[model samples]
Target: MDHKQSQIQEAEHAKRSYGSLLNVISKQYGSRDTQYADFSGECYKAVLEECYKKAKIDPSEVCYVEADGCASMITDAMELNSISEVMCKNRKTPLPIGCIKSNIGHTEAASSLVSIAKAVIALRSGIIPPNMHYDSPNPNVPALLNGVLQVVTEPTPLTGNIVGVSSIGMSGTYCHAIIKQNPKVKPTKEPASPIDFPWLVPLSGRVELALNTVFEKIEAMPFDEEFIALAHSIFKTEIKQHLFRGYTLLNAGQQRVHEVKPYDGAEKRPIWFLFSGMGSQWTRMGVDLLRLPTFAKAIRLCHDVLLPKGVNLLEILYSDDPNVYASSILHSFVGIAAIQIGLVDVLKELGVEPDGLVGHSVGELGCAYADGCFTAEQMILSAYARGRASVEATLIKGMMAAYVLKDVINFLGLGYNQIKDQLPPEIEVACHNSEFSCTLSGPVEDMKKYIDTLKQKGIFAKLVNVANIAYHSKFIKPAAPALLKYLKQVIPEPKPRSKRWVSSSIPEALWDSELAKYSSAEYHTNNLLSSVLFEEASAHIPAKAIVIEIAPHGLLQSIVKKSLSKCTNIPLINRFEKDTLKHLFQAIGKMYLGGIDVNIGNLYPKVDYPVSRNVPALHNLLTWDNVKGELISSFMKNKKEGSVIHSWDFIKIYDKRIQNFLGYKINNMEVIPPTVHLVS
Candidate 1:
């Protein structure tokens, strides 16, 4: 995360990097500092020797030198280049030395700092800066005469990892530090996060008001090129999360950030996992999630497996090319299954296992994995087979016109048993989501006719735009044989289910039976041909459970909340959100508040920002600056201008006793001070 570039954006960098430590170093010293100079030659040698020993490198590897260039650093006197040659005997060419003081002037106290800073820049850029105003080297210098030292009068390439820095103090305190090149890679033009997505900065405060106020402040500031770097700073969560927390959503497209209401939702409750099925799959569902490495890896794993089977899950889940998810039944099934696996992997990475679990319809594929019944590959391949088998019914042309999952407003559901006799026999309940909520699937024309009939009677119903295949119905019976055959071949045999795994498709009465066992092909075939008993499944959720919907988008949130009214329901993804990645983080924050031990570090990218040690303040130096005088001047100016005279009045009061005494003592005497005016 270091932004110290040697050049390129010179104008911008100049403002921030132009300043250096002036007070920490000693000021310029003249002939009186002969004592400090006496040890200069010895000091340089010791620093060089100590650096080589510490780094375990030879003198030949020290190719660049940042010299202090003070009065006596290279004096010709008794100090010998022949002595230096003996120390650096392995050198092929003279040591290239550059003077920073030639350009920035001798910062006596800060000379060593200036030298090191220049050396660091040189090491990073791999090129030494040219010494300014160097007409010729002094002929008296022993190193210059013996060719032991080469003054870098022109720009030169720095070829080694280590560079030596020398600084001489006026107080006889010689200090030296080494500058080693950092081999770390830096961010290029393309950042890890895509430009189209918004940057959500999760914020926390000790008090609720602070979160909102800080969000408002963030929104008021101007945005520019460095905003992504700002995202890195905001992503740092080491600061203790306080009682109140929230996030500010920033999109590069917008000039200002969108503020969200702050909350103290970390109320601590048991976390339950609920996986949503088919209708939740949307085109490009994985576009934002792919940015999450843990999630993307799972998706890629599934993609690599499913791609060879003529089903491209990556395109299905992340492409909005002419609604591939809706038109192709295979894409729909594979996309939902692939996204579910990714979501499960991300949840595990977050370190929150389901205290309780339920999966609706196709979501059962993900549920089986979460319950340890199916591995990542088995889940993905099972979904591929389910969709591949669904091709058997493609020509039949049927669709599911459900009462829910298309949107939140049509939250009402049908109790399948209650309405069993009312509908045409061709139309059957596909899913019983809640006490009054369910999905109805039938032939495409019949489904539309039924919905239109309801519409004429002023009842609202809409087509599930994401799904055109009539799943979980008699219409899907044609694909059952193929589905079962493929599933049996793919899964081979069912694994033992976890006790915490609740059944959404299988009723609670059959939970103890082989039906809840998800016994390979038969269970999946039966699941497709029968309605989802989600209401029966949610019965097993704990009274205080905090439910999280695991899918590319949310569909069963309303049903979960209604069934487990006492529990908290947090849908991890929203199809309508600007950035699903941000939505996932907010969901994790909710789970964290609900007592789930989520790994907070997993939510953000790894970052390492360089830090500097604290030093004495620059106020130690004497200056012509007068702050108090300016403050008083400002105060007087404001006081003079920022005032108004509202009203003025004069009051004359006579003291009866004094007036009487004066009038009696001296006749014709008027005891009055001349025009006395009092200003208060």
Candidate 2:
């Protein structure tokens, strides 16, 4: 009755606030105080008869009726009207009238909401609960005395969409709310279109064991339309006590869990993209990614730009044939460029962006394209011309090997001039990879001899497992001019003069004159001849930056990890892993942990599955606060031990206090006393 009165008071306030915009009308009455005269039971019956006549709906349309059963008189009056509405329809089933108060006692101010909630549940579930009391009808009521209505004695199965609930205050403030299940709302049981790729499901638990339980429950269930919809509905929420964070990827073949270490005390830092060069390519580097339209489109774009030169890049990428890698270096280099570009597109979609970028050898071409220095067509042409030069130099029978120096010896313990004099003319220091490591290039026999000499001194050395011609050495210097000449014809446009570039060829700090020289053909020719200053360029990277290797494998990441002082290495792709989809998602999950915001909607470009629009079940967990005493308080003040609580309820409670303090109270009592002092 108090709830009904509060609704009346709110409606009255709305009338004063909005003037003519408010439309208030009196409805049927039902209440716990069953005295017919006090709660106006006759008005309730009149409204029900009038509604049935006006809407032309018989009582048979309503499967069940929930009445405010604070007393027998209130329920008996609603039952009488049900019979009057169905008199002309010849309906056989008596409308099952139930009262929530019979089962769960009167809930005071929550009585009306509870009764309405029960009615909605009954309509959805098709079962009407029995009125616990009143095995015999009230003989005083006209409906029972005349045999016009019957009381439901037990649980009954109902078969209709409409249900009705009523509540009335003691002073005759009557309310009636009719609930009708809309025919347009579809069932969630229907099968949806299959997802061709893996879907990520974010899970959160208060403890480590809770996470294991969550995973076990998911593993036991079949992957279905509802599961897919639930997976895509993940959202961010505040963590409470000891959160176990990570996500699982669901696919047709198998499921994989990518566990993120529970967040430690750390701050968000910047990130860098480290793109890969040649020798990272395998036969089918991007075969698994072909299902994605964005990736496939990027591959098609490369094919279109290079097919005129008689190369089909997709045939090699999608084919399992071992000869694909053996045929030509042009195909492999072009595939690397195409895959990296496609990866950049997908990363942007996932909301993981790089603050800066660095690339190795031909990998810099993709970086150049990303920063607007090279267009897609120009990048393809440049890769092809460089690969052609490399294939020509293979005839010289020279290769590159990486070596780590022992004891930080200066030029092998001899003076620079003496060491240069003793060394063979064919051997050259190809790469200053780091402070401790360098790559050497020469004829195969000279490389073997140098390795033997270094091993005799207890220095670590190994031959790089690549079949390419020796880069950054004099042996390939003859191939540079022709490659540079072709690049100039194919790319005649002027440079954009982007300052984001970091050169691997020059070891000095880049000046404006040097930046402009990147546009000239001689600059590129010199790049092919001179050693790569990778260690020098790495020094330019800012402090606390994270390096993400964008490649088919983690080959460059290991080198970068050893070179940098205090930086983290994240690999976007892994050639060693067989499940490419799971590996890619793990990289994304790690980025999220590193404080990057991911827009999950972009991950689903094709929304044929009709994902559920509902918000996730787990929400912001409660926190401790000191209110009146030293006792701990959660964000949910009225929450009990095992009941679900809502944030909107908390908001409503505070809103009422604010309203009382602002002088909107029914009584003159002040919420904030004048004698009490308040702190802001």
Candidate 3:
């Protein structure tokens, strides 16, 4: 080890590579002359035997020996003789041998671990490099002359999976180990699929700045390298989920950050989905939501049902052509139904299923789908029929405008009742949306003039885009009979609705009437003609519910906030937002902030990995007392010392936190132990 006269120069002879450690054991033998340095060789032999037994390998299974050369003439020769002649006495041929000290020099205190690492590299590479500077055998060792042991003087093939290593500490402390290859090799993976969608990297800290620091750290990660693994690993770790949270959306090698928000919720509450009616569709609307497999599957299921009727829902929904993107009144109806159905399916698949459901106007079809009131077939067919009937009865032209009651009050100091009195004879209050909002319906000219009048007076109002057809008003009454007829053809009689469905059309007072079966064709016809009592139906939503809007745009977001101020409102999509995945996950992160367990695992693919049995589930959990100053002793099996108990009465012990033991409290204790000591 001292041959090179330089520590750095000596490391050149060592081989470095991956290794699988098997087992290690330590032995302490009381020396014969404890006052001096006399020791017995038999203790080391016993330790080597115990290590071989613990490794579940016989002495014959060891293909090579990692000699503790130490560059000592007497000790090296004696160790080799004991290993080959005494331990491996059954071997017929000389055993191959080498030492880590000969390559990396004597590392002194850390030499045991160094020897183990050396054996690991040899086992992994399946090759043992030559013993550095070795030429001839030492004549003092009888095993070398007798051909019982042979030093590895040249590069040799290291057969078998096992390698044995031995090293020594000062005095009589000896350690022996066996290291081998890992048994579980990774299986070959299948070809890649587009399973990696956007992931919400949840971040939290004790304070706002800490949250920002966490965001900065994640943003600086090498996401391109094993990104999915990175995402899943972050979830797998036992990091505390805190209230001050922020999230970054990861999708297709791009990321965007959502600013920090604090969660002050008492507990996770049930979720409710609010499906808004039309005025949110666009060409290529499904292009982004289709990225989710669950969403796409929902579309495919409904698409297949309609294909038999000369309608290709898939091609139409994803088509770039304005005229072909499910644009017809009938197909457009089906498209909206499909989008709502798909969004619901996607949310449920990610563990955010609704506890309550409500829909405005035709949005009821989605509510029915989730409530088991309609199948994929019944839902689309009904949409197609309703759309056809509505298109056929569009002779009377009308328009709609949404009004916020708070804005009306701010400008005109008026509520819905007062504002209705001022409206023209032809104008109608189509939807009493909430305590703070209502929608108006009338002839296009009248509606436009009324909206401009309101805007001129500093009131906030926006024309609802429904192609000059006012829903929930007399303008669409002519379509009632035909709509009922088509819906009857789809579901001939009244069908039971799931209790989860909360109708925006029928108020609770009418639940015991003929509209009890809300899924009936007659009920749908009434739904089209009657005003939407969304504010009245909002009473069905439980307190602290997370209300998610199932619409292309968050049309009912303001109304829901006004009606259910205690609930969290999450919009599934934005008509103007091109990055749908980012928008969707940020909403999910908001729900998470509201105490919803939005399944983190569902965002990525599942991977199979083998964890070592030795790894404790909670790494930081204390399983033993390590701070106690104590002595340990061992005896051979069946030896008389094994039955004997030696008790040394403790005189004194130091706790090292002595300086502050009895001091005034720094944090909690009023007084500390001045000097923690044991006196027995």
Candidate 4:
């Protein structure tokens, strides 16, 4: 490798070594200046002795010593010389001693660890560590002494636990650690309660304090059912707060309060319940809803509509059948079906109805059904037709995607206009997802080629994943004809408007009167093919309107939020799965009770969900407070065998506290800080 590459590799190796050591070392050792200190001969010997004891090895078995360092080369040499002197003078006879610094310039703090670690492995594997930079020893050390310690420029043989290492920090502290042959060790004992309640807060600043507080509480409190229940409640509240209002800590001594007085003049508008899309489903969805009589009743009503067409919607949804959800099409159908059914069931049970409703895409069908603009049969039939048409159209014609530049329309100005005219007549923009991103649908190969040409010109373009078929593109125009034909065959019926529903096909929200114009057979054919005027639609809405997305994925929510940020501050809601519903309810409840107030200590945790048993390790790692106590606890618990001994209960509390402070389960990466040392 070239010099620069070699340097980079060495640096990276050093970093990994440091990181591993930081993860395993005792917190006291890890936090001490010894990691970065300059060493005295005595300090070096003491460190080596500690390593030998920790590894359960006798010094007599150590046949060689190798040391390296950039900043403290002479100091390390003296230390190693002292080791040799101790061996001989104490009647242990003699051992070969060497230093890599005599060859390559010291690797600084990394040098000692690297050289010594290599020496340990050499002893275990029957090889020797090389001295790369050595030409001649310092004149201060006798030349005859060199004969006793071979100046090795090439690999040498080693055997058994025949290696010993010593490292000194620039600050006069030293460390020695031994590396031994791999040992057969038993697995760690499992915790009494395998599951741990980990915090999921997101703010970094508050994590430490939160964890500290939690650790103290957990340690003091008895582990009982009541305690667990309280823990669960606290966990749930915090999660809810974190999800709704991102994890944030209050500024020191800052306080703000709001006062409200009752208003008498105007009538309160009925609440408009917002439902979510997909991307929110988890296992055992709707189980909580089953507990609510109102929700159960609503599910029954949905069963009436969905079951007749050989769609056991609930069974299809709840069944642990992987095959059914293999594609976006099936996933979307199940997601939309479950949500719509759940919403209808919940509303019916509560006897609380919506004032208006709007679904982004497939959600629109649900809205139509809920609004009484179409019968459940008509809505499902329309949806099925739409779904089939979409799937087929996508299979035949391809899709288009663009990474828009800032001020997208202006950036593409002439280029976009020119492409629009030259493109296959079937292509059209489908969804404007973001200000700088849009999706297009048309010929597959043609779109690819078009994107490539743009990319060659330094314009960013790529296709959306999972959306292989273009829905809103002109290539699907032929499917429109089929849809039109299907719509004509279905008999129309006039129904009451139970709630207001918005149509993406039109700029204005659809009321009972507007339904008549779209009832015509021709409107379905043409309107279905045309792109929605989202910008115009956004402008016509109220600033504080609560816009709930009813699509399969929460993609529409993201789109609407990005597009309409300026016009309205509406809280967009998605009603996809049960967690989403819980979140939505929490949001609504908060808004109803009072506006959200973000106070650090006042924040509550979310309820705990039953996660897999395998999650505790990750959670512990992520949430563990890096405070001295917690760090020490973790080090003792997770260290290599014979490193340290600590109580299991203490470690568990420390782990939980760390999780609470971090506001999430710990990830493995979070367990060790960047400053940690991996090598002795």
Candidate 5:
């Protein structure tokens, strides 16, 4: 042969050897053959006829043939032709034939042998191998192959009758046959028992050498209980060593081991309720509250509707005008407007809500709404009036600062009596945040004096860096008269109390009498003039109450926890936890359905695995110029020789190149190339 021809021959020889090896492995693993391009219909018929003759079986007497490896080629062609011929001639009585090759790939050299073996085993066990990977045949191939052969792809009982198997090789070089009936094996009976020795010796250890002086000799034992016990002893020793190693590793500083306490079943579990609040709002407040269907309808039913009185509630709350502040009205208006409007909407959404509603100052308006003392519109209007009135009242007084006091009551006691007596009539205590903290508003002189005294007493107090007037104090008392007048004329009459509702404001429970009392002008005036002692309210309800703090930030939640140690607990649920309105609704639904531990972490779909990884070499070969050309040349030559070459070989060669390029130390023998059919 010429050099080129010599190389081609070498390659072909290697390919045939590989195919042969695959066949051996397939047979060993119990694989049967189906049709392969390499084996044609004529070739299969010739081989099967030869097998029948060798087995001394007549064609008519042969009940079934479990044909493997190129077996489907003949069967398919015959079926397709027979169907067409039958339609034309109206004939019948074709021999029954089955192809196991359709289930597994062609086993090549051992193809017929494997199929015969499986058939024999099936005939003995009364089971059959399935024909797998058969969807539809190519149009170029005869359609007779499409559905002619009835190959059992699932486990099936055999009739313990005679069966036939056949294999055909390239160039009609090889064929095999087998004839078998059923043979049975009986099951063994033995009870399981524990081994006496608990320690296992490592393979590397010499028991005699380790024993040195003290050793005991044992006699030869059969492979029965004694042998099994010895094996178990060795296994146990290995396990013990492994456990020691694990313990050492765990004690190492690199590992972080947590001491987990088992759950105490007796511990009482508290009911968990997640809370949501308003979106972060700026500029305008309560404007949307007037438009809500629930709020609008409720406001209309109230006794004295305040919203229709030409009040520009939005502008008053949103504005930063010095005039509004000069009159000491901005803070109260904004606070009340935020609280009432926010609460009204929140209550409508909640319907029947938590044990207690916790608000961050302004959120108290929402609490009041839950108590049924104020309709949504009335709350918004009242807030607007409070803001305007407070701003007007605090125009001359200095700004208020939220002070963190070491002792809130002491701070309040020192200032409430003394500051009230000394400061101008315009100053006041805005909010009682906690027992130890309070916000104060007054003229600059009085504020400076109070701060100075607290500092000297070793109390840490800082001014809240805010622009609005100090609220809940005497600073806005002047505006209280006007506020009370507006509320008395415009505030809505109290609605009937609902058992489903609860208030953070009252301790016993919300009743019409209590709500009506707060709704009166006198009570409204007192609320405007005096600071809200949240510490006092918190002390009343000292049980585990669900406190939902409504605000943009967690500041209110933190304050509630610190102020109401007896009532509130940790992991305080808020609007931000739910993040979105839809999620908030879902959380509420889950809560109502009693799924307290529900968590919604991620919502995106998982990514899919890429197919390229499975056939990297083939993929690379397709993309590589040199590899592709070689593959095409090989394929074309094979076709001319009545044989087809596979692209998988090129993929394997390219994969080797890739491994070398990437500096991988993998053995070439370890690399498996994909199989493809090459017809000869």
Candidate 6:
């Protein structure tokens, strides 16, 4: 009990204190037994179990599980209650397991990410990549040994759309993600239908050079049906900012890249709606747009309003017979009004509100309707009255022709005077369309004589296909009084709103009370014979304004472009395009690039279907600069990777084998480009 006994007791006390600290540390961090089990098994099990629970899907639905098999990472993942075993055990068809680590070696913390990426790629490509290096199953991993889960040693066809990816951390922190293939979410691709329209491909990059480079690469690539769809997918899901942009057109197996232009970061710009007039009307215009519910609804409402007036508008819109009542003044004006109004509805639904409106000839009626100067019924009634009166008043048959003069301003003054003196008395310059384009109207024979005389002098002049010669010329004078009388009966007084309406007849901007004068029958009648001041009206538009041609086919795009020069002009619809959906979405994409707000919910309506999640290759451009060169090189090195099935490939398969099922002939077969067909 002396000094030696005291020293021994002190040492024992120190040992006890140290041992207590060790026990506290172990308890705080988790038991060594549990940690080891987690790193090898239960951590992954909990992650996968929680993932499955949150996703509310059974393991049987999963086609495969991307496993964590890096070195000792496999030791814990192979435990009895691990994700693959628990998730796949009850299934009649057990889930297959794959390890990307086996192919490229364990990537450490990044290993899990690599595995997740591989799983995503596998799901998208519909090919289960082979799990390399495991000639024999690990004796310690019971799932592989007992056949509870199968490791995919060979490249296998993906059985279904859903896949589960698992990753384990060295510190017992594990994670699992569920990746599903939606039939509707797949990257945009060429549809089963044939290519019939020029598809606009929106292309952009963070910088001008980047955009140009991307465009050059795209241009050099072989053209295929997927080309347009690929461009669309990128524009829809990537390129959040449009600093520099250019778009290409895919037509007849050729891709043409437009000049790249820079976008000045959003200074709020006004949007101008350019309503095209009579010549814009075509047989079956808006026929394809009927597929859009909102557009069709608008057309139906308009048709209902015009039907009682005795114009079977739908007959011209939906009929396969292109000539059915298409050229009549009554049918043309009513049809034109109905379609333009429908376009306004569609544009509004997509959040595009115009700041100003302009119209050429009968297009002014649409502008009046859009500006709230008249109701839909009133607008149709006015158009009907105008059409009926014009037909009733025409004493002599006349025609209009487009004359591209060498000098527009001169033609408006001195040149027009000289031309007027030389031409027959009946001829008159009706419309000054652009700096160099104008419309010549007179008696059909006089107009023909003038056109022949102009051609003799080597002038760029051609006969315009127009049924109604009652626009902006004396030829329409006989109908003016009748139109005024009819308008007085229909719309007695115009209630003008504050919305801006640019009168192309005067080539001037007018709004609110100023538009009231046009409501009178006499004013409307006088307007029918006035010169179209299109250039002057265009000059008045704001420098930052984006001019949109709100018509079925963008017949006015070139006209607007010529008028605006450097300003951006977007065509709301493509006249030559058969797929109205593509054209509508492409226009929206172009709108987005121009800093326009888009209502995504309204753009894509609610639908119940499985969408494919396979996005196009251009989506890779989203992270183009961030991706490693080695990774790209390695990806390109795999010859079998080239053989992987893709959405485009599937489309080709459908074209060659599935399209003619049961030997039935499909009506209106879409023209398949030679490039896509030749690939097979």
- Give me the runs in candidate 4 sitting further than 4 Å from their true place: 1-308, 319-331, 344-357, 389-395, 400-426, 432-437, 452-467, 485-491, 494-502, 507-527, 566-578, 590-680
Clashing pairs in 2: 32-70
Model with the higher lDDT, candidate 2 or 5: 2
Please report how far candidate 2 places residue 230 from its true position, in Å.
3.9
Q: Model 4 — which ten-residue stretch has the worst lDDT?
A: 18-27
CA lDDT, every model vs. true structure: 0.64, 0.61, 0.68, 0.44, 0.40, 0.63
Model 1: colliding residue pairs: 25-109, 25-110, 26-108, 26-109, 266-593, 269-594, 413-436, 413-437
RMSD to the hidden true structure, all candidates: 17.3, 9.3, 13.4, 23.0, 26.7, 18.6
Which digits, one per residue and each the tens of the lDDT, describe model 4 over residues 473-512?
A: 5556767766666666653544443425545555454434
Worst 10 residues of 1 by lDDT: 613-622
Q: Better model by lDDT, 1 or 3?
A: 3
Clashes of each: 8, 1, 7, 59, 47, 20
Residue-by-residue lDDT tens digits, candidate 2, 277-369: 756787788887777666677778888988888888888788888767656667777878888877777876766666776777666776677
Which residue runs does candidate 5 get wrong by more than 4 Å? 1-352, 358-362, 392-399, 406-430, 464-470, 496-521, 540-544, 565-680
Better structure of 5 and 6 per lDDT:
6
Candidate 5 C-alpha lDDT tens digits along 361-427: 4445555565566656566566656655654563454567655544445433333333345544555
Of the two candidates 1 and 2, the one with more favorable lDDT, higher being better, is 1
Residues 355-395, model 1: lDDT tens digits: 77788888878778898888899888888888778776554
- Given candidate 4, what's the lDDT at residue 110? 64
> Candidate 6: lDDT of 313?
75
* lDDT agreement of model 4 with the native: 0.44
Which model is ahead, 4 or 6, in terms of TM-score? 6
* Top of the candidates by lDDT: 3
Q: Which ten residues in a row have the lowest lDDT in candidate 6?
A: 18-27
Task: Tell me the lDDT of model 6 at 237.
Answer: 33
lDDT of 5 at 41: 42
Candidate with better TM-score, 1 vs 2:
2
Structural similarity to truth (TM-score) of each candidate: 0.56, 0.71, 0.64, 0.40, 0.38, 0.59
